[model samples]
Structures are given as structure tokens and as C-alpha cells.
Target: MTTGAPTPTYPARPRRSRLRTFLPLGVAAWLVLEIWLLTVVADATSGLVVFLLLLGGLVLGSVVVKRAGRRAFQALNEALQRGGTPESGGGNGLMMLGGLLIMLPGLVSDALGLILLIPPVQKTLSRYAERTVDRKLRAASAGSFGDAFQQARIHRPDGKIVPGEVVRDQPGDEPQGPVPPLTR
Candidate 1:
């Protein structure tokens, strides 16, 4: 019989996660809303007024984001200095994102961003972030597997019996050589 050709097997492609799809849609909606607001502002107010408002929003957002960023960095640094991993869940990136959202030409985004920039809210967010990180660390440490004997036996301060093998090697003895060695 003639040799048959091999069948081709294609590799499966990885699908994009829902978050990836939703984030772009959300950003696009925000942009469209901002454009609509800009048009409204242009129609209702003079160019000078729009410019002033934009400037004010930029300045306010910058100040808020900067202060939050500094606090977040300081907290992260302190944690790292104490031999712990820095908590970055609610870090400068989030604050910057909020500030940028505020800079969009819309009242709603600005208000939401302002709320996010508040110190009390940021502090609460940071505490929650820290706790989350702590929980993850604890879970990871707990989940890790070690040598069975490590857990099987633990020495007590008082001479008490624990259920496990204890092997002790003494330092003194030497065995005689060539003593009826091996039989096949």
C-alpha cells in the first residue's frame, strides 16, 4: 500500500478575557460622552469660559493625583523597608487614571474622579489593598509544601514524645575494613 499523507493539526488560539473586551468598550463610551459634553460646553459657554474650566479641572486633578501618589508611594516604601512586598493595588496608577478621567470634558467623570481623590477614600482603599495583599501572602505561604518530616516532627521544650522518626549520627566510631564483604 502507498504511504498516506499526515493530517494537519492546528494549534488552538487563546481567547481574549471579558475584561479586555469590556475595558475598551468602557473607554470608548467615556470618550464619546466627553466629546458630547465638549460640544455642549462650546454651545453654552464662550471659548474663554471653556478654556478656564479646562484649566481649573487640570490643575485640581493634578493636585489631587499628586498628593495621592505621594501618600501611596510613602506607604509602599515603608512596607518594603520593613522587609515586606509593597502593596500596589491602589497605587499611583489608579490615581493617575482617575485624574485623566477627570480631565475628560464631562462633569460626571470629574465628580467621580474627585471622590476617588479624596484622602479618606484613598486611605480606606489603601487599607483594603494592604489586607488583600496580606491575605494572599498568608495563603501562598500556607499552600506551599515542605519536606514531610519537617511537619511530622517538632521538638518540644520539655522532653516529650512526638510521632516521627528521629535519626541521630554519632561522631566517634570507625569500622574495621575487609570484613567478609560481599556475596553474589
Candidate 2:
């Protein structure tokens, strides 16, 4: 046998997605901006006012999230009883997101949250998001995770793919209003 060195083999590292690479940096920048803005507001007015504003936002966001969650649940129940997949929500999910943003401790987030609560804005955002996800899923390679997402769609009896979500109830949630009786 000839004496020769063999090349070592190693598993290739997976490429990082753009969102993964940049999200931390973006979050850091957002935190700095929010802190700076809070200080500016405190300097211009009073720290107590800022505190009150944040508290008010927290309460309002809580209310918004509760209402949206209730509505979404109701819609889901109605759809399940009808034995049909739920139509994409009428912005309740987006409203919940807005509420979450408002709950965050930042004026910028609060402003964005308030804007998202608007019906037109929510619809526009929802459409844009749908289009973007659809584009990404279509562009995904044959054997990738996106292909799994593509396969996860619910197809209608008439043979059109419809996106859907799987809902799970959290602990401590009590059923309110009339819950549909379970059938077959």
C-alpha cells in the first residue's frame, strides 16, 4: 500500500437566514432608540407622565388582546361546527399582535400598536403578509423546510390550497358564552 494522507470530512454548516443574522442587531437598535426616546420625553415633560402613559398603554393593550382573542375563538368555534376550515381571521390576530406591541415598554411600539389596531391597516398588513409567505413558500427548494410548509396547507374539496392555523388553548382559559355541543 502507498503511504498517503487522507482528507478529513466534516459536516457542512447550514447557512444562516437573513432574518436570523440581522434580528438581534435590529432588536438592539430598537432598544437603544426606545431608551433614548424615553429619556427625551422625560426631559421634555415629566417622568411621572411617561410612567402614566406606559401604564395606560398596558391596560389598553390588555383590553385589545382580550377582545381580539375572544372574537378569534368565537370565529374558530363557528367554523369547527360548520365542518369547514376557518376563513382567515378578520384582523383579530393582527389586533392581538398590536396589543402585544403596545404592551411592550416603548413609545414607538405603542404608536405602531395603535396604528395596527386600525381595520384598514390590519387588512393591508394581513394581505401583504399572506403574499410574502406565499412567495417564500413557492420559492423554497424541493427538499427544504419551506416544502414542508407548502405541504402543511389544507386543500378545499374543490382542490385549492388554503392556509390555516392550529389553535391550542392555554392554561387557565375558561370557556365563555355558549360553546357548541360536540358532535361526531
Top-TM-score candidate index: 2
Clash pairs, model 1 backbone: none
Error of 2 at 87 (Å): 1.2
The candidate scoring highest on lDDT is 2
* Model 2 ranges off by over 4 Å: 1-7, 11-15, 140-184
- Candidate 1 regions off by >4 Å? 1-5, 69-100, 104-106, 131-184
Query: Looking at model 2, which ten-residue stretch has the lowest summed lDDT?
Result: 175-184
Taking the tens digit of each residue's C-alpha lDDT, what string does model 1 give over 101-149? 6776676688788777666787778788789989998876774355444
How far residue 21's Cα lies from its native spot in candidate 1, in Å, is 1.9
For model 2, which pairs clash? Answer: none
Measured on C-alpha atoms, candidate 1 has an lDDT of: 0.73
Q: How close to the true structure is residue 134 of candidate 2, measured as C-alpha lDDT? A: 86
